[model samples]
Target chain A: MANSIPAPRAEGLHYLGLRDDIARRIATGLLGPGDRLPAERRLQADLGIARGTIREGLFQLEAEGAIYRRDRSGWYVSPPPVVYDPTRWEGFISYVEAQGRRPATETISAELIVADPLLAGVFGRPVGAPLYRIRRRRYVDDRAVLVERIVIDAALAPDLLSHSLDQSLTDILKSVYGLSVARNQVSMRPCALTGEDAAALGVKSGLPGLHVQRLSHDAGGRVIEFDHEYWRHDAVRIDVDIRVR
Target chain B: MANSIPAPRAEGLHYLGLRDDIARRIATGLLGPGDRLPAERRLQADLGIARGTIREGLFQLEAEGAIYRRDRSGWYVSPPPVVYDPTRWEGFISYVEAQGRRPATETISAELIVADPLLAGVFGRPVGAPLYRIRRRRYVDDRAVLVERIVIDAALAPDLLSHSLDQSLTDILKSVYGLSVARNQVSMRPCALTGEDAAALGVKSGLPGLHVQRLSHDAGGRVIEFDHEYWRHDAVRIDVDIRVR
Candidate 1:
């Protein structure tokens, strides 16, 4: 890559508190994980300094895990990422709310569909078991964000279809069926939006999206429910509370 | 969000297999998050079905956390999300690989700049620390992507600017300083790109981006590094992995 050097600042590798400069860059959002630095020759020429000073600065940043250099790809920007603690099984709604963003939903088309092999496995019923389904679009303000369809065990939630679901299903289960979801898992992957989804959300197809799959269990370890959350890339942040091992 | 009904499949809901249909919509890019499904009344009219049947179909989909519904504005897509396990400390190289995507980097700009107070506090160094600042750009493929820079820990990484690097600094620490990182706290917030970031990523400012901040610690619990990763809104996906209690 060609150098896009701007007005030369202080040049030279002489150790005049270089570590603080590097540390400062990180604090102010300059350097990130997975970024690369220029060759030593160029750096020395531009900074007008010895190599030792730079090495010392890097050593400290490295110790902190602020930057990581691959075998060949150079240094990179590591986004502040949230950790998923498997021991905490709250649903997606709770996850968003935990981050202090309001979570809201709209009921879409609700209908019954015949289950297939996979649905059978998730619902834990025979193939072709009668399954109740609801398709809803979720959002943050004007952004028509995630489009999700939920499946229910019709037998388990007989009158579920008639109820207004303005709150959380887990809450509904607790109030109606005396069930408490004790744990859940969320898995995600990079995804692209489709024409139908685009048309529904008024977005163009091929835009990046996050596909989230969640599975929950009750206190007795019974599979409570499983759902997929198709979230827009821009409107959400998943937060995690972590502890050092 | 407008309600775009799920067109009845050629074989109807039974043959389409409720589970497979949802997955296909996501995988084939047919349905997207935030796309509102047709109103139950409209869906029945368009799909030539009873309203009650549509409700049953939607019920199952909601249980899986695939979508969120609002009380008034209709259903929207879930935003890009991830369930991360923070118990283990990791660099970007390992993290991206785990997601089944390749991460790459390039040098952007690097030079010494006067330390500001905020940076000085982060590094635990006195104010106005002279640092060897390095800026780098990162990418997934040919996409002109994220731009990141790092402020070296002026004391430990002496001569870090002297070496040609595009590799993992964690590895460098293991090989050179013998310092190992063991913990970190990462967080993210949604933001618009700055002129500098947007220009580097080939986009205009005011577009959305993920602004992340992290403080990294060492084996002895010393906070050794701080990091910031700002990603273009269109090109990145943050996966949320959760383990629930």
Candidate 2:
């Protein structure tokens, strides 16, 4: 076989052409972490492109974790976030640092949903009991790579919604309410991401995702939290050290 | 709102079309586990259909794990098979039986191959050292749902190829060689299936698969096996009861 191998497919990077410029500047050590990116209008004017084109490029860059944005705030360069090991079952913070990836949580949505038939039994509650459906996305290196939905019994966890949803739920449960995933019945499967999940994960629909569904309980086996994790395939691997069956 | 709403999509099994003859037979208990299925030629004579139509029916049935075929061995009514838990890192027999499914091993391929760059480190040998690459498909509910490739270091396991590839490697190592997966370093991710995997799993390419890559060793950390498990999306779950890091 020829020793020279063709380079990796370069088709998708064109959309992020300007993104490369920004990344190159960062890599060249000219711009450091926490440095702000130029505004869309200004970048467009400088680059001789339309504002919409610049906006799309910015979106692509943000999706790739090349930069970060604050709401009504500007995009900023950031370091890579930490990774969460699903197997370590650590609270979010420790796991992030362990993987040497940056980690951030943004509670995008939270709602009080009526526990319907299936969820009622799972949460060990009566039908129509109030349940907290908390939605959050995790960022690693400024790239949002995973989305999660935590369903907790509202009556039991009165302060569940009070805690920072953008932060680690594992921490909230322990520090705030003395709850833990003392025992979890977890099931993982592979699935093609739906349009909604794909958007949350910053990947295309029809791409693979790891569906981690858990029924978490207290030490007494009292059910406490129902967590659903939608994980990106590329950036994370669930490392399991299985000592027994 | 109406007391009952039609599903936005399929809630259960309605979308899965089951012909009356097939449905009735299963429903009426005329067909049962481990029973031989009528051959295409025989079914054509009995049901008065073209063989192509019969083949299509078989494909659907296979998707549902209602039927199975052996290579040149003919089709047989399927019995429920158990899913082996890679995450649990248990012996094959116990884990399978505990899941309320049968465990059957039929070794399709086994041979000694020289280790490559990556396998060298995993097997604790130099590149080009002899190793056994064994291939197996794990069945759940009589449906073959997983394809596994296991590499064994010949130094630790001389005459490895002589053992029945159909027997559980874990068992052979424990009983015959007194080795086992006392501790496993497993990394799992979601991936698309390969063409060979698709053929073995009776699914087309692009189907989702769980890639469970693992390093198994004894208490002293001598690497015994390096395994790559390609699993069907719906069949197995990677679960762990973790002590938080």
Candidate 3:
């Protein structure tokens, strides 16, 4: 792999060629996910490229999501961004695991709460209806990527708080309650992280993120779950295939 | 509308109620796309809410993608984010129009360029293949929202530069060259705008944006279009519904 790496081209577009060389290293698995790149000064010494050119190439790669900077930390190859498909019935754990990444969910809290007026309006249920509120943070490659708050119709799954709340909630819904997700109404928007969410994701408050809300229904079309998800913008790419029904 | 709006709640979470009020205005069409809100001082006076409270509410709405703040230009209601469905054969103009928004395209440049090694590998063609390069900026509601650079095989469309490049390239390919898009391979990631792109989109360089690259194949499975799109992060949302194939 080292022998095949090309030398930088002429001065005018040396950064482009340098970018290709680094991208090749990433594509060939020579630089795996979470592997930190050498410092800019060190890389400059090794490649015999000017610091400016090296910085430009690194900036381009970061913009392309091929790598990311962890604040004061150095640059590291980015994990493949998770592809979220709303139309599939496959649970999140199954699909994320299918991508050859370790997927883990940590329950932050789970408790029963009466629906607020806003929640009632969203769920179309009467105010004061009992709802099971769950907050969990999901991780990929040991990095926290997603924080979700879910509210379930407590009547449908009684004593839900007593059951294990880790792993895939969709799977638990099926095995414990005989419910399957029939469809999901998902909405996505770009947002900045709130202070609490920023702390959870290890980023400063007001850093841009992605906000995704999913309202999933059961096979009988009963509203089963309402989920609000906040994701680090750099950690995922969204893909959807729209076919004629 | 005034009577329907609920007054702010107690002192502690006053911003929450104000945010709900502003969100309701957006949802009810009281504040249409591109409609600018009152200045912070005026809003504070009208709502009898504190200035800090008003600012917090506005901040929340911006994070929710319901509105946006233009640098030095004040706040405005955001147009509904376009829903791009790659599976449908509809051209960019039609789907955006179907959502009741006017779509316009401005051609920035068109020329013939020899394919570089990267382009040759991506298109599965030999190097030096003549490719038609077209650059365009797209608008909705007269606001620049997307900038795209397309590279197409020039051998398939002779004299392509002579045709109007201000509309959907897919439509032009179908009508002028009898080439129809069969399917697309689309990938999206969060990106910060480049200096050139930032100048075009009227945003600061390094502002987070959505980077979408698409490879579209013709009916006979020949790759016809390679489109790279950059969009302002606040102006658009990405949603894709996946169904079992």
Taken over the whole model, the C-alpha lDDT of each candidate is 0.56, 0.68, 0.79
Per-residue lDDT tens digits of candidate 2, residues A1-245?
A: 11222221254333255666776889998888779988887876566666765665665455344565655668877554333455555766567767776678888899999989999999778999999998888877676778888899887678577676876777777777877766666666654455578777755443445677877778777788888888765455566666653
* Chain A alone, TM-score per model: 0.58, 0.65, 0.78
> Interface-residue RMSD per candidate?
11.4, 6.7, 4.0
Instruction: Judging by DockQ, tell me the better candidate of 2 and 3.
Output: 2
* C-alpha TM-score for every candidate: 0.52, 0.62, 0.69
lDDT tens readout by residue for model 3, B1-245: 12322566554466777777787888898999889998988877776777876876776676556677777788899877887655677777998899888899999889999999999987888999999998999988788888999999998888888988997777778899998877677777777776688878876455567888888887676888888999877767665543333
Docking class of 3: incorrect
Instruction: Enumerate the chain B TM-scores of all models.
Output: 0.60, 0.66, 0.79
lDDT of 2: 0.68
> Pairing residues by index, what is the TM-score of model 3?
0.69
Candidate 2 structure quality by residue, lDDT tens digits, B121-162 = 777779999998889987755677788888898888889787
Scanning candidate 2 chain A in windows of ten residues, the lowest lDDT window is A1-10
- Whole-model alpha-carbon lDDT for candidate 1: 0.56
DockQ of each: 0.11, 0.24, 0.22
| Positional deviation of residue A111's Cα in model 2 after best superposition, in angstroms | 3.1
Residue range B72-181, candidate 1, lDDT tens digits: 54543333333234445565556656766566767676566656898888777778876557777775544444676666675666666666556665666556766666
